[model samples]
Target: MSDLREVAITSDSSGQLWNACVWDPFVGTTLMTYKGGVSNSHCLSFIGRDFLISGDAVKPLLHVWALNRQEQIQVRMVCPGKVGALAISPDGSYCVCGIEEKLHVWQVATGRLMAVIPRHFQRVTCIRFTDDTTHFASASEDGSVIIWPLCKVVSMTQDIFRSISDSAEPRYTFSDHSLAVTNIFIGKGGMRARLVTASLDGTSKIYDLASGIMLLSVVFDVGLTCVTMTIAESRVFLGTIEGKIHPLCLHTPPRSLDYHLTETEKQNVFSEHTKSITCLSVSVDSSMLLSGSLDEQVIIWDVPSMQCLRKLQHKGSITNAFFAIVPMNVFSNNLKPSLVLSSFKRRSDTENEESYCINVLNSERILCDKKSENKESLKYLAGQVLQLKSQVKSLVGANLELYRGLIADVWDGHDDDEPDPSFESTQEVGVHKKRKIKHKKKRNLET
Candidate 1:
């Protein structure tokens, strides 16, 4: 296994052609391109470090690629219908394909069908495995999420005589969303592992997996399409249908029915996308954020600064985007990560039709402490310099006017016209005596 970090992009282009391209971010080059697969679906995932599993919606097949061997292993008839979603177990021993409302579990090593579980009433939108691999979750258009135990599902495949009643029910089923559940993500391993779900009902909810209670429900104005959490899980990054990214702090209580109306909430919004935001991915380190939209743009954001670092263009609307660590030993210094994006080419005649394409973008520069500090310092210094220059110019103008006024007074010979203090006092006394005499004359005339 190579230690090099590579980003794999899967594109569904026009003409029913799918291309999977791998990029080396460190060298800024395309390492490989596997083209001409017949899948318009966005069901691609990395199975361990070597194999890539892709499910085709147009064709009922699963294509597995071994990067080291440069060969593809085809698993035919994986699903009866189109593969709506897919998830691989953390241990990489099993894979699950979501076909409409049913789920098909397959053993990876032997490519044998393990079990078929029919659960959701609507098409499954997303699926994910827990960090421990003991559980997996599926979200559906029915606005519900069900967490299933991996042991029970595997047991059904092994023991035919075992009564179906002996198998336990799902670990938990969350039915809080009113509309289709667009995405679901299990928190990183910890004591407080949580499940976060986004829905078309314009809300995202956080649930405590252990207690099976809703911890927080955040309501937004626009429907949420996707979500990702930070490393600490203290904040959630959400993608909305309005092409906006909203970061909600878990610690803060919801102030109103619409959280976006709050003053504090306004600052965290990233509004670069002109079309609907389709996906969001945060780096493992939690320092960078990647967002892809129907606007055909992938924006790299500095999480702390909330500033866009780079923008990557796509030939079509982006379906999915994520950041992954490159295998370490390939680079002299393993500093930067790679961005993988899956997009589709839009049809001119049919606005609803699109084909997929994959793009692997290289991050030539990584977000660093020194770089952030320097950028801040430069901005601060530049502002101070501009302020000081303005102040100096104003002071010079005021001083110049004062000097001109003083020179005019001195040059006008106004000193000779200055009044004497003694004459001014005598004039005041005479005016007072004249007023008293006028008052006595008026009294005598009345008598």
Candidate 2:
């Protein structure tokens, strides 16, 4: 386990404690630690291989650091308010920073300000890019999901409110959530794509991007702390503060409405973590899963087996985490991606308590530190994500006619004459053709 490395990070607050740290889990090694800021670091992104981008509370700037250089690459200050979230595009050309009330897109390499996309009335919490680089989705504290065209953002800003003129206008807004959206992730597998989101109201919603409709909804007893998707398979993982993890298998084609879970997979709870799970990271290939929790622990589970393989403990509550995968070599399949773990502890808690330190743990020992955050900043960002979701949803709704047009193209043909009865069934649709073929074969064999 010592072969694994560690980096620690911490952020600042008034108490000089509760700051979070990111580090390697094995042997309690430290990698990068950010401490003593006005607000805690809530969002992090790995840009251009070794460069890391992070969003904090008070500093309206997004912190960019060169991981190999172990130094700050640039402090990108663009937003007027606290930088609440950060997301890097797949190509690493564009990075989206979620400011308290606005969103800014910056070029990662040159640190150039590409565009300033104003946020909604509510604060923006999370920003994510679709599998295809053509678009990105954002969630707001207002309980909405806004899908934006990456290519048209700059141009659209010019006539920003054009869609607002008609209140009854059919647009692209998706406002199904009744509460603030805390997390949003786009899942891609096979030929289908899904926008997965979790909210403060203890519900996880899955939306079909092509149709811009809510496809599936799951309610949990506890508020959802985070939601994540893997690339290798169509698994949507949700972490709830109520001490449970729900995994959903994304469906496609004729069975799209069948969102029920198998008996063995329902309420798949892992009780090792004493508290809520805050963040999650899946291996690039989706073979492994890692989770950070308020219980001062990180768990690495075998995705296929759903068995916990490692229990990495921290000195305090874990804040966030990311996996750094090293390219494969001539001898091995691929070097296991090292787990970059982050944690935080309250500074003033009694000395005997574990709340005062951040710990990095891997297969072995845990590293510890005591740092905290300014509570105001955390609340500010959490609230902002909800607000941004609504504004984006409204923006989406403004383009609703466009989405409907797309669906219409698929479902409703231009031919004035209705389709023949034999072809009218859903089985005639291209997506469901294979299922229909299978059913026909079974029926013939039965006869």
Q: Say which candidate scores most in lDDT.
A: 1
Off-target runs (Cα >4 Å) in candidate 2 are 1-42, 74-78, 109-112, 156-171, 189-192, 251-267, 327-447
Residues 7-34 of candidate 1 have per-residue lDDT tens digits of 5343433323234544433233555544
Local error of candidate 2 at residue 218 (angstroms): 2.3
State the displacement of the C-alpha of residue 254, model 1, in Å, after optimal TM-score superposition. 8.0
The superposed Cα distance between candidate 2 and the true structure at residue 18, in angstroms, equals 12
After superposition, candidate 1 runs with Cα above 4 Å error: 1-18, 23-31, 38-42, 69-71, 74-78, 157-168, 190-192, 253-264, 327-447
Residue-level lDDT tens digits of model 2 in 66-115? 44443344443444567777777776667776776566665444443446
Q: Model 1 lDDT vs. the true structure?
A: 0.69
Q: TM-score for every candidate vs. truth? A: 0.66, 0.59
* Superposition error at 441 for model 2 (Å): 99
lDDT of every predicted structure (CA atoms): 0.69, 0.61
Q: Candidate 2 — what's its lDDT? A: 0.61
